[model samples]
Target: MDESFVDGVQGKPGSGLIGNRKFVISKKNLAAQNERGGEENIATGWHAIEFLLWGQDLSETGPGDRSFEDFVDGKAPNADRRRQYLTVVTELLVDDLAGLVKAWAPATKGNYRARFEQGGKESVRKILVGLGSLSRGELAGERLEVALNSQDQEDEHSCFSDNTHRDAVNNAKGIENVWLGRYVRADGSTLQGASLRELVAAKDAALAERGTRQIAASVAAAEAIQAPFDREIVGAKDAPGRQRIQKTIASLTQQSKDLVAAANAVGITKLTLVQP
Candidate 1:
């Protein structure tokens, strides 16, 4: 999904600096293409919605400033198409998510959830792999390090909305939730139970404690990076914002190592993760 968004923005930026398809691609061409949701090199998905909502991020200290009037038919170019595209793409996203929910539903008799519950060690390994991938390869590397190294505002994730800071915070929070086996519902309720932390603690209590602390440190550092992640990656090498981001990156890196240790503690010897 992210790859498709990148291809669209960087390659076929059609009508606007953000975009409005070059030409509408049919659903037939999109089949068998998971995450690669495009034909004729068009962009769709989260970034497309973001582009429509907030054009290009031309400002130095803020995000794109697309006006609501743009969606008011006849007030802006491609207003009708914009509305139609939004509806279609949003529905597709929701549909895809719904499928995932059903697959993971606890009550499902023979879905992925059932298979996973019986997977045991393999399931635990998969969980650690996913956490490792997200923490190091995705969040720390592609999202943070890329922008930090480039110092280009466009490199920032969710650049259209200046929400990269929140992205990092939320991602770190997700890792924490999984480690602690806790989830907070939209209704302000939280669910907690046995988790990766407990599993690691069973073998090595000190390692579990270290992993928890490191995860918390990463969350704190990510939260401290401030809004407008573009700004945080710019200025002098020792700038406060830059330093904050660096700290977050460092914390995330260390936590990835801690996660590897946690995995090993749980008897998963084959710990393989992509370099961030």
Candidate 2:
């Protein structure tokens, strides 16, 4: 599914950007080929969907220049096939999310829910471990640091749509949700419960408040970067582009430290900020 096809089928209104058939590669098709003892490049997932929807970001001025006629009937070759592929991937994504929702439900018959329900202290530890690890390692290190260091557009989380800024902010929000013990669903409903913030507040109210403020600061810093992240990492260290990246990194690093302190305040004595 080419970016143009995605835009077209989604009713964005435009013609296909490039008429090449090579971009229609489907992961389901690739899996079938693999099962048949054949090798096919597997490049399908959220990023692939983004690529199909936004194509490649070939300019600093904007996102991929894909048009929308690729999925209109009789407008482009294999338009129907492109539509079918998009439908398949979209359905699969929804199904996967449903599975996660089921697993995380309070009454879920799974280890994930069971472990959290075992005890309040156990739950707190699990939550802080996840929060600390995500802030110090995955979100800060892998997502932000790796992309900034490499200065590669392909390394951008949503390079095609130039939406990595959203990724960073949302990631911070996720951390905040765990701390506050709340999550909003797609239908505008929220799941609320005891959270790390509540736990830490009981032990040390000031620390909990600090953690909350730090999380907000990090989110604000990330959202303040004016350019797409890929473009922000394109110059010398002291350049304005790199300066924006550094500011966000500094904010995340401080928040990570605050998260670690919050964990400690809640009695996680051996909690390590850096995880393998």
Candidate 3:
């Protein structure tokens, strides 16, 4: 039930086939699923749902094409099981997000959100640490370098949908949103708060501007790359696509360094750029 099922939906296009839908997820539930804690919880999260939705990127021309009927009342083997799994997983996702919404809702008290909002410097340090760690280790080293070194499509972050490029762009956007202290909520409302950008600028405006530019450059580098990072690495021996990916990696690395500087500006002097 991995990616090979892509062949089943190749010719079909929306006859209860080959389309995508949205699902809300609970972060805590997601973490538990990923951790599994040496238990029976199979790795279930966005990628798990993505696999069930898109199947796999078996096609060189485009993304996966999973059929909705695979999970509906049908003659297909395991149809009932598939339908039940999808329903339960999606319900879990919705329940998780409901918890988040309650935690972060305006005027909410004594939850994670209140603690984050109240502890100013601690929250800022946490944000910088996350941004720096993600850029330096997860995105730059693990995700990009491993794929580049092996030229393996399976290393892609969104391999099922061939959407790793979008993932990179969106990650950079998230970094930007944190620095700018602005983000659009799931309900179409805007949320603003104390930002790292303002915090840095209070001490050194040039450093702040440099960090902003580095973030933008990282995103631009990601966007400039051609589609399907897993496929693009195949051309590393001849084509220029590899160079584009390399450029994006460099951009991410620099942005990560900038994040460390920003963290230092905020008095968190013990930060380290982890690599894994």
Best by TM-score: 1
lDDT of 2 at 94: 73
lDDT for each residue of candidate 1 in 7-102, tens digit (9 for 90 to 100): 223354344312435545333323223244344233445766676677678799999887787668888656666666666666776777899999
lDDT of candidates 1 onward, in order = 0.78, 0.69, 0.72
TM-score of each: 0.88, 0.76, 0.80
Per-residue accuracy of model 3 over 1-276 as CA lDDT, tens digit each: 233221134465331211211222333434454534443233454666677778766776567776677776665545555565455556776777888898888676888888888997777777888999889798888777778778778777777788888888888788889888989889999999878899899988999999999998988988887886776887645568788888989999999989898888878887866776
Backbone clash pairs for candidate 1 read none
Candidate 2 overall lDDT versus native: 0.69
Model 1 stretches with alpha carbons more than 4 Å out: 1-22, 25-42
lDDT for 166 in candidate 3 is 84
Question: What is the number of backbone collisions in each predicted candidate, taken in the order shown?
Answer: 0, 3, 1
Q: Give Cα distance to truth, residue 235, candidate 2, Å.
A: 1.9
Candidate 1: 10-residue stretch with minimal lDDT: 1-10
Task: Please state the error at residue 202 of candidate 2 in Å.
Answer: 2.4
